[model samples]
Target: MVLLLFDFFFHPFVPDVLSLWHQEFDFYTLLLSVVYGGIIEEIMMRWGMMTLLVWLFWKVAARKKQVPPYAVFWTAILVSSLVFAVGHYSVTALETEITTPVLVRMVILNGFGGVVFGWLYWKKNLETAMAAHICTHLTMQAVLVISTILS
Candidate 1:
């Protein structure tokens, strides 16, 4: 809900890096983004990277325990989310200037969503996290389409 409101209100003030609808809206790109962003990102960030980070922490830091501690789990989520945010910037590096402000904005805005999805993946399941991501993309695409039509 907060994320939705953030998109509704503050999105225009932010850089296009954080905006959902970037280029001219095409159904194919929208569909592709929703599907790819939902599935592949979650698989990479949550299932693969986060799981590995947690397991590594468990192995090195908490060798006596069967599972990682809560602190380690949260560290994994945060680190993985930071990696996710960094990945976004890397993809767009050629187009945009990598200023401090832009980097901060990307980290905070996208990283917040990453943390939410990571938490959902940790607490609920991967499917739930993917659903949230898909819904987010779908909602943004719907808003863009409606606004375009209305305009």
Candidate 2:
């Protein structure tokens, strides 16, 4: 997908925030990061923020007694994703020398994840989206472990 491509290309450009893994690897540090950074952050961003925004929008729409089209949902996803990217940018800038490409990739990837979450929301429900988000975060932890072991 376009979003995926953009993310892949741009992620390296995003300034690194919190260089937790410097020089030799630390197993405990990785574990802590997986617990706090991966799990906690994913829950807060994808499930908490994304889901809450959708519900709030739905509530507002229901109050207006207007059932907007799926475009409304798409818009919400896009907006939330942008905000998420911006938040990451701030964090990244604080810790790393973010290049343009890194920032672009980070934004693109987050946006793509938002789209998937939005789709999950439409297909199954908000809870399903949260599950998907958590699964993705778990997978990232697995990736980190595998990479560390391999290298």
TM-scores, all models, native as reference: 0.82, 0.62
**Residue 77, model 2, lDDT:** 71
* Model 1 bad stretches (over 4 Å): 4-23
lDDT of 2 by residue, 1-151 (tens): 3443453454454433332112235567556655654456556665677667766777776546466456566666777767766777775666666776656665666667766766776668756766666566555545546656777
lDDT of each: 0.81, 0.60
**TM-score of the candidate numbered 1?**
0.82
Q: Write down the lDDT that model 1 would get.
A: 0.81
| Clash totals, every prediction | 0, 8
The residue-by-residue lDDT of candidate 1 on 1-151, one tens digit each, is 5565655455566567555544357889778867888999999999999999999988989989876799888999999999998888875566577777666666776788899999999999999999998987777778778767777
Error of 2 at 11 (Å): 6.9
The prediction achieving the highest TM-score against the true structure is 1
> What overall lDDT, based on C-alpha atoms, would model 2 receive against the true structure?
0.60
